[model samples]
Target chain A: MIQLIAYLIIIVLTIIFLIKMIPRKLKKSPPYTCGEPMKFEKPETVFYRTLSNILGLKKLQKLSTGNLNDYLLMIFICFMLLLIVLVMV
Target chain B: MLAPYAVPLLICTAFALPVFKNEKLIKAIAILAIFLSLSFVLSSSIEVFNSGTKVFAVSGFKAPFGIVMVLDKFSSTVASLILFLSLMIAAFSSKLVKERVKEFYTLLLLGIVGSLGIVITGDIFNMFVFTEIMNIATYALIGFTAKKEGLEASFKYLIIGSVSAVLMLLAISLLYSHVGTLNMADIISRIDTNDIYLKTIFIMLILSFCVKIAVFPFYVWKPDVISGSLEPVAAFFIGVMTTTTVYVIIRIFYTILGIYYSTWFSIIAIVTMIVGSFLALLQKDIKRILAYGSISQLGYIFLAFSTGLAFQGMYHLVNNAIIEVLLFLSIGTMLMHKKMMEKISMYAFLLGALSLIGIPPLSAFFSKFFIITGLLEKNLFIYAIISGLISIVTLLYYMKIYFMLKQGEKKIYWPIIILIIAVLLLSFVPVWLQIFKGVEVDLLARNEYVSEVLRP
Candidate 1:
């Protein structure tokens, strides 16, 4: 329905605004203790850093580091998505 | 009809300020803009009182046809309280934002604008829009600290907030599909109480609001979000923003849906009170303690609403806002703004703490009395008794906060002193101007709200 799609559009726009507009440039930080940190010690590839900056994907920095809380977030989102799919179907 | 520029004036000022980019001027502008907003709100509230409900029908469309902003007493009262607390926050926090001054005030104003919109709008979709605006602004502000804990807390809020938003949209879609209207009054007029989807929509809407207010089983974000942010921001979150959500939920039940599902609501309220009290007792941090206490106060307000004493519930709402604002503002100053903090006297600190704990001769106690009285009047003796026991637990934790401060040298300042005087006078002055009496009773003026918004 148009109403359903309209709702999704509004929520998606909000998500984009959250990711792209807010959360200022990530400052320099110590490298991860684990091995996932890309060896950009010489500071190559501005595009990757830009991607990291805009999306705040701490993929490399947060490698092998985690919290129970993050796991809980995972579970919550999964459960909610399941419910939404069920209702929609 | 008062023009609806009051909300937009704030939004326009916020968006226009980035070019100037001066910190002092930004603070001045935020404060002045909030002050003007408050002036318009109070004056407009007077007009609403004299006339009927004030409707700002956008684009020359009326009622069910357009984005309508309706200011009844209930909405205006909450809106004005939000603006009042916002002004205090702006003035209190001006000296605090050394970095990101413009962004801070801009987000703060935008958040206020959202809250005002939430309180005023008659359309469910507009309510969703306002709620998201408030939540997003809150997300960015919570992230302002840039510390991992702050961001983590903010992200937690984002996830949960996003879930609530989706639920809100789904609920609105359900309502629209059922009745083909987004206007709250129109939906109410067309609501088929016997239909099963009505119950589903009700539950969904209640769930969405519960997440925002951090009710039981969904309050995981409250402790982190309240403790991680700066103290006044925490105060604003717990005091004003939570009040807005609860107010909307309460209004939905009272004004629109007409209490077909009140028993379910009562269950939620009772559980939130007891759980929130018990959790507050477990917390060591003052912010976390206040956060949990905020939940407990919300439970009391909910209890009042379930008993069909929305007026009493609103009294407690306004009263709780004052108590939380005083507690958090003083505690925040003590923790963060020590340099600018003037030493608060025991009279002020003890009054705020005792008021929160619901001691006699304070407005907080009186509001609780009204709620308890309402519960008892409805013959919900069990609920009244349990609520009483929770009050004891509440006093225990609030006293814990009081004793925690005793070990340190205490500090109270002019703002707190003024608040202390205001609290005492608000309760002590027993004339017609009793702050609780006017709005407490009128919050149940359903006919006025229904007629003004629907058939105006």
Candidate 2:
């Protein structure tokens, strides 16, 4: 237990030392493509767009069009399907 | 005895709010009323733990013949949780809700009354009535801002909720026709699961509740609804409204129908989880993302229930509710004071997001761990894997929000601070708490529940 405690203290001290002593550089620069600065799409937007495309989420979102008629239609379809499935079961 | 007082107390307070012109006085009265109701709920829960189920037959009429409020271990525990969360929301909303103070408090108290009524009632018809009251209050609350988007979301939810309510009422009528009683226990005793009519009734009821709890295909309204509402109201929806609906679904399936697992339901749960996670990934707005995350979490709870992991499901439900409330209320605070976002609020938000992602030593992590382990025990390795993968996706969206709000000043928001502390303390629940003791057994002990409710 003593050894474990000593190890934990050492780890804590190392973290504190690293945080306090590290020379930090904070600056903003445009992305470099070859020798020129290039405009880049935000990574978050790119990631989400890629994910949405790969998952066919646009199709799903289209189905959830926030239309009252569409929602009612979906519920009706679900209800009918449930009835059919349960009757078969 | 105290169990029955929550609904009446809140209802009376709601009506009394309109009489007071002083906004501070109205807020004080509303908070005091909910505080009193919460105290009563806790006291009643203690009584239930010390003894057993307490059944109050309304107006001296016996069960099956009149309205009854059955306060059992399950009901009392859920009711206490609901009131506790409501109290938190009420306190937070004191500053959050600015316009139409009387209307807001009145509607909020009425909504609480409806929620408590749903939790405690023994009659299925009465449950339906309470649900309507809750839904109506929610519709007005969702559109309280009177913005275009808010009104649109409210109108949409109104249409869906009305249709689902009709389906539920139809199911109840069919059930009454077949069993000749509206009392849940009585219906359980007479229910013939093998019969086609009975099966139809069960499906209708489940489908309606599926919509109410925002399961997939029926869940599209939830994100829009949450995004449209004021943040505190959104917190109420995520924390109390959905949680109570989940309780109602569990009560009906576990207690009334005595059906523990269903393949179709599990399929729907899996779909709901996948859909919610993917949709959440595509969202830029914090509220919409959390809303979709909530839908995904509901899928987890439903999947656990589908596999007969009652304790794990309930644990996840409670943890998810806490984390969502923390996140929403924190975001709400930031929105309320946009120029003065606080470090404590940001830390609280991050903690909630991490917990929702099932990070180590957090309350949600344990619940997710139990759920995964429970699934493994049931030999559902694929479902367990799916749940874990979705947790990663949950992390992705919440991290997106984290990056957006990485900077804030050092200050304290009391409600978020309290919730953060609560989230930390809940991590100890698995090891030290007996709060959920016998709850799982009680859920499965339909025979005991029925006998007690039907006893002479």
Candidate 3:
């Protein structure tokens, strides 16, 4: 029991020391980018755009433009392709 | 018997709605009428589940001669779901829709009629008629605001819907000429699966339904349509309209055509999942993100369907519908009452978003688990993996919406709260009801469906 109490005391002291060691004040500095501040992009934009490029989704996205004629053309092309595949199968 | 009556009741209520000028009276009557319609559907669905399939033949004429409504396990369940969502929409819209209250409820009921008719009707040509009715009503509802964007979206949808209708009628006529009958059961027995013309008809029919259901290349209209409309109307379109069209596709492919598997269909489903997720990742608008999310979710359903996992597909469909309605309505509530009940509204939206992401202790997770297991059973390891990865992407996009929520509330709490409870209860369905196994068996029992409709 004495040993256990001693260990608990040690754990509490360690946690207190760690908490006190954290800097309460710090110097602020602008990020260095060859003496020019970097332009910031939304994390969502960066992550998704990078992923989208990797997946070649730009072409698909391009086709999804809200133009009615584009939608019709794409539907027609897909329909014809489906018909061909069905006939072959 | 009660199933067929829902359409007329809704139509009658729709016609009667315009006569009343008082907004409160209009809202009361609309809610009462939809409540009645829901009760009728619920009772008939219970009858189907308890006894067996019920056939309601019009004018005492039998199959292959006159129109009939077949209330089998599948159709009854889907019909019940459609009406239930309509009721929730009616209740939610009562508080949100103040301007043109009469016209709004009237169009809403009319849309319900179209969807209910599509689900219950057992004739192929009747299905075509109901599809058109649903399409016209949907176009009007999308343009209900009469805003520039809304009108443009409505016009685009109208054009696409018209072309699809033409394709559907052409296919149906060709089918009738070939089979000499419009009754689904009769046609099922008469169809020669090997015929070339039958293949053409199948492709054409699928293309038409694809437009309605908003499959991959055809899904461009949905986000625009959803973004342009009022939030509750968008909820109705996303939750009720798209799902009803999916039910039609399932009925046609499984019951009528007897097609249980197709490689090309599964490929299209996978592509739809990939494209929808990628596009959703790119969207900044909350509604558009949800619109694309629904498209991705539908792909999951189609994947399950194409892989012979109809039960799992349907389970997911129910989960997706509830989640979508909850999310859309919560957002609508937040926007309408910005200061009143922001805390509860935010929590509701968070719960809905989590459910959509398929987090554990939520309904979608179980349905998605079933679907993945089903794919594994069929040795579709790649498709299973893809679906799992897409869920992660789903989480990412949903987080975007979560980050966007500001605050809001009031009066619409009951509907959203009821929906939240429904979503929670659905996770326990397999444990409590033990109904899914029976439903799965019934779906595979194509011969039973045919016999029920044809029995004199």
Report the poorest 10 consecutive residues by lDDT, candidate 3 chain B: B429-438
What TM-scores does chain A show, candidate by candidate in order?
Answer: 0.30, 0.54, 0.49
Off by over 4 Å in 1: A1-89, B337-342, B345-347, B406-414, B428-448
Clashing pairs in 1: B311-B440, B343-B412, B344-B411, B344-B412
Q: What C-alpha lDDT, on a 0 to 100 scale, does residue B55 get in candidate 1?
A: 80
lDDT (tens digit, per residue) of candidate 1 on B1-456: 553678889999999878786678888888899999899998888887666578888887988888888887777888888888888877877856788787888899999999988998889899999999999999998878898878877887787788779878988898888889888878777875566667667667776787778766566567777888887788778777998998888778777877623665688789888777876765567788888888888888887877777666777787788778878777766655443333563455567766766566678777776667666767787887677666656665665565456323544345566666667766853642344455544555666666777775
Error of 1 at A27 (Å): 53
Model 2 chain A — which ten-residue stretch has the worst lDDT?
Answer: A17-26
Q: How should the candidates be ordered by DockQ, best one leading?
A: 2, 3, 1
lDDT value, residue B110 of candidate 3:
83
The number of residue pairs in model 3 that clash at the backbone is: 2
TM-score against native, each model: 0.81, 0.92, 0.91
lDDT of 1 at B386: 79
Q: Which model is ahead, 2 or 3, in terms of DockQ? A: 2
CAPRI quality band, candidate 3 = incorrect
Question: If both were scored by lDDT, which would come out higher, candidate 2 or candidate 3?
Answer: 2
Global lDDT scores for all candidate models: 0.72, 0.83, 0.81
For lDDT, candidate 1 versus 3, the one ahead is 3
